[model samples]
Target: MRLKPVPVEIEKGKINVDIDLEEGKTPFIVVYCQGEAKITFLPEHGETKVVTHQGKVKRVKFDEGEDF
Candidate 1:
């Protein structure tokens, strides 16, 4: 359970979040879009997706928050 501060960029109508993790480490991302922005994900079993490799980039269809 570590905390990281990552920068997000919004382009067109999409947002991108990136992660940099060490070996044998995993992360859980929870994002909530604010204002006139809306976001969604596929295969939405949104919770506890783990990353288990060093310098590995894993993608998941995790959607846990809502926008207004």
Candidate 2:
């Protein structure tokens, strides 16, 4: 299944996204970043009646690091 990309705004040095998922389905997110950037997912989870999604953006660093 091809999921359309959703644009998220950076708020207070962070980003938040909410999407619907069907029950018993495993859903993943595709994060696209421009230029030199890093993304880290923190150990966190939120659950409701049916869906369970985890994590948050920890930090994004764009600096001189080891060549990739």
Candidate 3:
């Protein structure tokens, strides 16, 4: 199955991404950024993952709003 890419909005140096996924499946997201970038995932369980990748692109796996 091919899922549509979620829309990401960047405003004032902050990036906002809202994604919806199906249950019992794992989905990955590839984000392209210039230079170094930091990504933070805030889940419903109050667990947060802060990731910093120094490159032009980053690929992260998502499972039930879990960490990367």
Candidate 3 structure quality by residue, lDDT tens digits, 1-68: 22334344445555455544554233334344652333333334433232447743434433445446
Looking at candidate 3, what is the lDDT of residue 23? 43
lDDT comparing candidate 1 with the true structure: 0.38
TM-score of 1: 0.29
Measured over all alpha carbons after superposition, the RMSD of each candidate to the real structure, in angstroms, is 14.8, 14.9, 8.6
The TM-score of predicted model 3 comes to 0.26
Q: Could you estimate the TM-score for every candidate?
A: 0.29, 0.31, 0.26
Give the alpha carbon lDDT tens digit for every residue of 1-68 in model 2. Answer: 23334555555544455545443334444454542222223212432121223544333322323434
Worst 10 residues of 3 by lDDT: 41-50
**Whole-model Cα lDDT per candidate?**
0.38, 0.37, 0.41
Backbone clash total, candidate 2 = 0
Candidate 3 residue pairs that clash: none
Clash counts per candidate, in order, are 0, 0, 0
Of the two candidates 1 and 2, the one with more favorable lDDT, higher being better, is 1
The most accurate candidate by TM-score is: 2
